[model samples]
Target: MKIILKVLLYIVLGILALCISEMLFFFILIHSNNTEKGNKTVIMKTDSIAHSKALVVYQPSLMTDSTKNVAYDLAKGLNSKGYDVTIAYPGKYLSTDLSTYKVVVFGSPIYIGQTSSVLNDYIKSVNNLKDQKILLFVTGGADDSEQLNSLEKLFTNAEIPMKISFKYNDKGNENKAFNLGSEIGKE
Candidate 1:
């Protein structure tokens, strides 16, 4: 009986240690700043002289490039559809002026069922979003309804025409993101 009790205690302790480590990792990931040089803003201008402008803002993940790739593909799609797309990371230097943009898209990677605080803060800092055409997308292991609902709540005053989720391992996510941008440009 004594040996069995000891084994059970050890198992419980092992699980507790794992949970603590996981929580620590998540905290660090959430607070860590990404200073990658490639994360600078990129503008994709359409060939046509008459083109509407669009902005794609996203918070890139430190662990993966999937979110960044999706943002670029989305911008490319908008560019192909006669929209001048500006792709930027959420930061202090990012322009908050949305007056010139016909449409705006925001994206972030969902980690442990939560989106990045940086992206959320940037969105909140912008004013007069009620009249803007906003679209949202999240990349994660699965489509989390709770996370999507939470993101939607941030834009309560605005009309979000589309909300999409792309899995990290999904092969066609870039194409899907691009297609979404194209669809938005058509409107």
Candidate 2:
């Protein structure tokens, strides 16, 4: 009986240790992102589109982040190339008039192996986008092929130029995102 109690106590302690470690990892990821990037507020400014300008739309995940987001990374990239950029969240910006911007970037993270609902709705709402450039970017862990393929199909059907889909890592890859944004601005 004593041996059984000892084993039970060991199991409980093991579970507690696992829980603590998981929580620690989560806290680290959140704070790491915050430190690397400043505030994460969505910028909705379109008043400066009279010059070279771009709009980036994305929806951040719960417990994930908005500041260290792939969308903001690309926006920063665009900024590096002298284009005025505004990054906005889909829930707030979907119905916005996008006629002034020269370039529009749709960015989102794959949720449950699919494109996020907010992003999908924003994409559907876009109309009369003739001659204006449209870009698609998605961030996700591991295989995003299914989400990528679906996005490509949507772009192909709409006759929009299909850019690259960025696979998201926990640690944001700002350089790659910046390169893509710079290239878009040059075009």
lDDT string for model 1 (1-187, tens) is: 9999999999999999999999999877766533322357789989988899989998887778888889998898889899999988886677666778888998888887888777777777666676667888888888666777788788745777788888886889888988988888887
Candidate 1 ranges beyond 4 A from true positions:
1-20, 33-39
Please name the candidate that would achieve the greatest lDDT relative to the true structure. Answer: 1
Clashes of each: 0, 1
Compared with the true structure, the alpha-carbon lDDT of candidate 2 equals 0.65
What is the per-residue lDDT of model 2 for residues 1-187, given as tens digits with 9 covering 90 to 100?
9999999999999999999998987665444322212223455333334457788876665545532367877887777676778776665434556787788887666655666665666566666566668887777666766776676565423455755565555444677787787788777
63 in model 2: Cα distance from truth in Å?
Answer: 4.0
Instruction: List the global CA lDDT of all models.
Output: 0.82, 0.65
